[model samples]
Target: MDSPSTPRWRKSSHSNGDGGSCVEVDDANPGHVRDSKDPNGPSLAFAPSAWNAFVSAVRDGEFSGI
Candidate 1:
């Protein structure tokens, strides 16, 4: 398990200025995701391949208007 301090969180570039929806990621751990609104809350981690697939889908507009 990664220590609480291990992952350096970065807010998504796609995050809106209004702060309605926010996503944060740990680039060091390509599979980890946490809410920017709750840094200390539970997070979800995906497998490397799964994360890649998800990112690809997003880039391809598979999840547009979401």
Candidate 2:
């Protein structure tokens, strides 16, 4: 893992490529997430299990209406 302060971030594959609303996730620290439009803003961190559950929920359309 890299330093938390400078982890490598990747955009969601679902992101719009024309500078639209997007978020970035750190590869080195799987649960670290930040807004792509606000790189210096505060980021959210989750426990690995929590992150996995969130991802699973997204894949299952559990957040579609919200």
Candidate 3:
């Protein structure tokens, strides 16, 4: 994995324009995620396949109850 500085982060499209909870993603880095509220905070990174599976699950409503 590359250093955090190498990942160019962008806010998730699903995030609300209002001041709701938001997450930023580094698409170039596959699974890097950081809170929009805290860009300088810690980030969580996942394996590419794991990230894709999680995204698919979310889109498929597998975690709707959460």
Candidate 4:
């Protein structure tokens, strides 16, 4: 995992103003995800391909109504 200090973390645009159900991603390094509510907590990293697939599934609503 990359050092959290150097990573450029950005909150999702979809994030609520009150900070509910939000995620943060580090564009400085691809494939890293951290909870917006817990910036110092552990992050989950994925391969670029895997991350794309995950995003595609999300856009397609594969997990809708779950």
Candidate 5:
């Protein structure tokens, strides 16, 4: 198990192949997110429920208003 300060990070499979889109998530730190391009930059934290809802919405195309 990874420590809180060094939570395991994994790149999103949905990211662009050309590396234009880079996003990483820490499973050990649920609801924690940060930009892969800026590991030392700021991070965003959300409630686990909120995070799950956001992911679910994206997967369900709930935000496809285009």
Candidate 6:
């Protein structure tokens, strides 16, 4: 799908200053994820509901320490 117009990238709050596994997300269009190290690289877009579910899972520690 076409990239959203001028997506405003926001750095993840969980990102450490050492730059180890950082992620950037586009709030302009929810569910869009791009690597912080490669802003111009490909992005993964998910449906809003799916994204919410994924976030919920993360919050619930469904995928922890793996």
Compare the candidates by TM-score and give the number of the best one: 1
Which runs in model 4 stand beyond 4 Å of their true positions? Answer: 1-5
Which ranges of candidate 1 are over 4 A from the true structure?
A: 1-5
Better of 4 and 6 by lDDT: 6
Question: Could you tell me the lDDT of residue 26 within candidate 6?
Answer: 88
35 Cα displacement, candidate 1 (Å):
0.6
Q: Which segments of candidate 2 are over 4 A away from where they belong?
A: 1-6
Question: Residues 1-66, candidate 5, lDDT per residue (tens digit)?
Answer: 444666788888767778777888888887888889998898888887999999999899998783
What are the models' TM-scores? 0.84, 0.77, 0.80, 0.72, 0.78, 0.80
Whole-model Cα lDDT of every candidate shown, in order: 0.87, 0.88, 0.87, 0.83, 0.83, 0.88
Candidate 2, clashing residue pairs?
A: none
Please give the lDDT score at residue 56 for candidate 4: 86
lDDT of 3 by residue, 1-66 (tens): 456557888999878899687999997788889998988899999988999999999899998797
The CA lDDT at 10 in model 6 is: 96
Clashes per candidate (backbone, < 3 Å): 0, 0, 0, 0, 0, 0
* Residue clash pairs of candidate 4: none
Q: What is the Cα-based lDDT of residue 22 in candidate 1? A: 95
Ten-residue stretch with the least lDDT total in model 2: 1-10
- Model 6 scores a TM of 0.80
Candidate 5 backbone collisions, by pair: none
CA shift at 46, candidate 1, in angstroms? 0.5
Residue 14 in candidate 6 has what lDDT?
Answer: 65
